[model samples]
Target: MFGVLVVRLPEGRLGFLRAFSGMLAGRWDVEGYVPPLFDREARASLEPQGEATVKALFARAEAMRASPELLTLRAAHAEQSARHASEIVALRERHEVRRKQRHARRAELTEAASKSSTPEASAHAAELRDSLHALDQESRGDKAERRRLEATHASERSSLEPKLLRLERRLRALDRLRHMVSRAVMRRIHDTYVITNARGERRLLRSLYERAQPPSGAADCAAPKLLAYAQAHGLRPVALAEFWWGAPPPSGGRVTGAYYAACRDKCGPLLPFMLDGLFVARPRTFTPPSTTPGSLSILFEDRWLVVVAKPHGLLSVPGREASLSDSVLTRLKARYPDATGPLLVHRLDLDTSGLLVAALDARTHSALQRQFVHREVHKRYVAWVDGIVTGEQGRIDFPMRVDLDDRPRQIHDPIHGKPAVTEWRVIERRGDRTRVAFFPLTGRTHQLRVHAAHPLGLGAPIVGDRLYGRDGERLMLHAESLTLLHPGTGERVTFDSPVPF
Candidate 1:
């Protein structure tokens, strides 16, 4: 990604800083671009040493694999194996022919003995039986010969194996050494990164990722480079924007010239640390989906389960962070202290308001979860899209995957994406907006939201979608109703929540 930061000088003059995410055309220090967050001199020395050793090791391994002595031994063994197999087959075929001939002769002798009517018939039969015994002895001799041939071949083949095995062992050792050397080099390279926050607090880049190895190009994202430079140079950042400027990978869904959010994997951890001293006001704050906030809107409850009209901005389950402890699951756990099993059966997007189900016991939870997994549960979502949809009803089938760059944002990717299907029908068309109901056939993260916003789907962003389109008072989407089989009663049940826009 490429980024530009609108900056304010100490003298109150305005200027902008430009930065690219990582190396542009294999050069880290471009003429006018801000430098990366690493020690250049340290890398200059460390990278070459590691690269040279890795290359040399690879070259040696490749040479050893193609050595003539090894190849010749392998060829000799293969050729001998084929010859032995052919010889054994020929010997078996000959024995088979001899056995068939002996059988035909015995049949002819038996027929002649049966036709004879006198004493010669009995004597002839005895002679024929004796001949059959001789043939059985010949068959045993052939079997012995076949076993002897196989043993000889095995002994001959073993002769060349010791040399071949020794050569391969050397190659395997080289591969292990190469891997160790490469890992050592990368570890040192990570150590060279010295990242700083706005508070001027310094830390190693790898430290931000904790025990995990920082992903490749960890401190090299456009956000970090721009913010880090601004912090270092005493420039105050007023505004920032990042956009894709080049061809995206074939498996990627990024569009050239399209603005993008900061990548979560590389920048998610770094940005929070870097923006420590900045008063970064979020574009929008969580607003209640209904008239009330922090109060549970229990739609239905029974001995086995409970369904709540989850307000928007409330997480379906408690978040990992301590700050995000307020959620539907947390509230339920507080109320039903004796509730057994994981209370949550399914989840809704944090910004989506809708009917959410929770089982009071483990058996109910398991059964309810099965309904969702098998697509037996039905959900209806009410949404007001920014654009007036042209059709009355249609199914949107855009396969989706999480945008690796941005958390919680999805992109259309048929190749490396899960299937997300939505059946929708227009309820009302209001000037430039359309109110619609969406029935999702599959449950994925941000499924309904993405199906509404993606160009391949409805070609319209849900009104007030901050991530997909523009920010507003709240995301104009709600889980209006949910239908599922009651685990306790063995009957179908439906729950409804008023659509709050």
Candidate 2:
């Protein structure tokens, strides 16, 4: 028989080995590898907890608003108001009938007197006039009585309104208090937990909670929960990946299996601490271009304004990273050194190749921007979608908002979303893909892309759209044309770019 040796490795040594493995995987690992909430019961129970708490508070507020005493008071007020309204209606109806009767009698008497000049007829007419005068006095009394009744009704409503208002204010205060408590609870949850860095250093939860405002759904994210689980279990943290599963969210940027970097505001500080012990590899640096930016093709140019055709993969302007500092704006500025003011008037997504206009001077820029703000400028795009279109043409009206989980991604949110509209026409169908022309009525971010992909909209994701569709060589979307009034000549000018598939 052979004796077996059992060994428990030191924490430092184990951490080092894990770090080395993490570093090796880090080059291609852009997304968080947190395990998804696969348990239905767990996800269902966890998500509704906060919502249920808030709803319970709201129910309590409703109860307070409808307290026994308040309910009684409201019921009494409603009864009195109904009674007063009915009385007023009856009184007016009676007075109107009487007045009409008197007027008819007076008219008959006057006509009889006019036909006959006899003293007897005149005397009868005078007697009728006396009766008419009495009727007039009665009508005046009715008016005064109506006025008194109105005053009484007003006084009653005034008395009841204050009590109702007091109750309403109390309910509102309770709501505010409930919201405050909820926020405090959320903050505590975000602050009490701990996150371990790649280097295996654990830090307080609040240290990683830095942001101008907490990122959307910060308390409910899976990354923190996954890390907490790893720490609790004796598991080594190696690589992190988080992907969106289920139906794509509103903005259509999220696709299944697509890797996304951690959000700057939400996961920026937290990821650093979480990856502390691991040997995290740096992202490959993108080299700036040395050649004359040939991708920026000038479409139209004048003394005050210029329009340029921007190719895919080139930024409209310099990005935050120094490597991405070279862009269309930079190249144009370099070419026209004498151009004044901010040259680029508008922007296009780096992934979308399109026509963009710029102003050479400040005044022209202001005028051109005004046109955009007033919706005088027109923009059109062409794209190939993943599915065939059954309809020849249609319109999409979907409201959009930034996704709380993913910053760059947008979701359909009718309540909080800005209005976005797009009109689309099928141009051609090549096998499974359909080429479409898009007319954007409202220039919301990702308006055309979302409109094409959203289930409620077109239900066809753009071909080569990594965010909304399957990953491909490129995003098959192009800004085909732009039409705007020239600020200097006061003439409408249209710029066109050939669609590049």
Clashing pairs in 1: 263-405
State which candidate has the highest TM-score.
2
Off by over 4 Å in 1: 8-12, 18-239, 243-261, 264-294
User: Number of clashing residue pairs in every model?
Assistant: 1, 23
lDDT per model, in order?
0.84, 0.72
Q: Write model 2 residue lDDT over 228-337, tens digit each, in one string.
A: 44554555555555555556644466555555655556666666666566566786454433433346888888899888898877888898888788788998899889
Best by lDDT: 1
Model 2 residue 463 lDDT?
A: 83
* lDDT tens digits by residue: candidate 1, 174-258: 9999999987888899889888887889988878996757888888888888888898899999899998776554333444556
In candidate 2, position 30 carries an lDDT of 25
